[model samples]
Target: MTTTQSSISSTSPTPTVPSGSGRVANIVLDSFTEAGRHVRIIPRNIEVLIFATIQPVMFVLLFSFVFGGSIQVPGYPDYDQYLMPGIFAQTVVFGSVFTSVGLAEDLSKGLIDRLRSLPIVQSSVLIGRTLSDLVRNIITFIAMLAVAFVLGFRFEGSLTSAAAATALLLLFSYGLSWVQALIGLSVGSVEAANSAGFLWMFPMTFVSSAFIDTRNLQYAWLRTVADVNPFTQVTNAARALYNGTDPGDAVMWSLVWSIGLVVVFAAIATRKFKTSSE
Candidate 1:
């Protein structure tokens, strides 16, 4: 019996993993798992799905029919074409509020605490939340585009240019999601996060070239501010690309702004998350 026990012990196999590689794998797996949880929730909430689909559709219709006649672009015959990119930018930017509200709700409900207690990677929650929000924004973008198409919005640019424009808008929204995540982590409640999320966006969008040409503004100061606004750069880039016009330096500036936002906000959010966990 002693010989048998010794033989069994000696033959036992031990598992080994490279710590760095293992951690990376865990983070990837955990993030995707968390993202799947959020994605599943969308289908279960019928009202949320309905509202998400309807709101952008409403925006496209209302803006195209009600305001199209009155609003004029210097070189365009169809205002709908001019209007679609603005609506696209607006809708996607507003979609980031969901991230803030969602994270705030999770924090308030003690879900963050629960997650902290788990063995998963610490950054997975933020990564997953941002990714899920990006997916939601994509859906919203598609719905809005379809509605815009029915309203006579067409892409005058090559399909590749239109696709690139869409990608830029999504990248901008992704960066904004990180910003919202930081806001969500900072705020005490979902209500505060919701209010805070839209507060900045209103001024930014209105003051930019999203709805109109910056040159058309009555005040020189307003035009100057709009000209320098990051939102203005993004909208102008999208408009130029969609209309097959020379995108010029707008695209480069928009890319830089988006990348900068992602880096700064992501670092802040990750630090806050670690602090909260402790």
Candidate 2:
């Protein structure tokens, strides 16, 4: 056991601080190294990769065909136009869950203990994990986009607007990846992380304007909840951009919310990662 632990601990080389002058560069380098390691493992674990790609595609098909015609959302008679962005928002949000599950799995396998013994930047492990998940999300997004286009979902907005919308959604999901980082570190096992990470998102996504416009919601309280929901801002912003509609302040508010979540959750999760132990 001692020898095995030593081998795992040696996976990363000692990082030099040099009175912290090179700390930022060190973090970038180390984080990239860790990210590459995680991404490379994806192919070896092909089953998980397949499921990750399949889920969002399945969602697009189901919502675009099944629930789409029955539900009438004003200003979106085509339905696919409005629904695609919401589904994109939801897909990226769900993609962030991999962070928690990945971190928890590493912890259970004693990888965290091994990383703690290394001299790398303390935050590199989490950053690298999240970055790798972002790459996965990008791939999933591309796959979903192809399917959406086939279903008559055109980018009604200019190319620039479409790109900006995609970037905003990715940024939002990346921010939530930090939140999941804390969840993964706080939980006892991968199963706990998986359950805890996903339990709240149903209400988070469903209660918002992701599926239906806030105006169409029958209940006042539900509409209020949807209005206050940050996810609503994100979905609306992306939806407006994709549809080439005047977003007003939705884009700005979404950017602020996304950046805020990233800054706040990254700090909290990094702090937790430092003191966490089995």
- Candidate achieving the largest TM-score: 2
In model 2, the runs with Cα more than 4 Å from the true position are 1-21
lDDT of 2 at 228: 87
RMSD of each: 6.1, 4.4
lDDT at 174, model 1:
92
Which candidate leads the pack in lDDT? 2
lDDT of each: 0.88, 0.90
Tens digits of per-residue lDDT, candidate 1, 142-247, equal 8778877877788899999999999999999899999999999999899999999889988988898887877899999999999999988999899989999998
lDDT per residue for candidate 2 within 162-207, as digits (tens), equals 9999999999999999999999999999999999999888999999
Compute the lDDT for candidate 1. Answer: 0.88
Full-model lDDT, candidate 2: 0.90
**For model 2, how big is the CA root-mean-square deviation?**
4.4
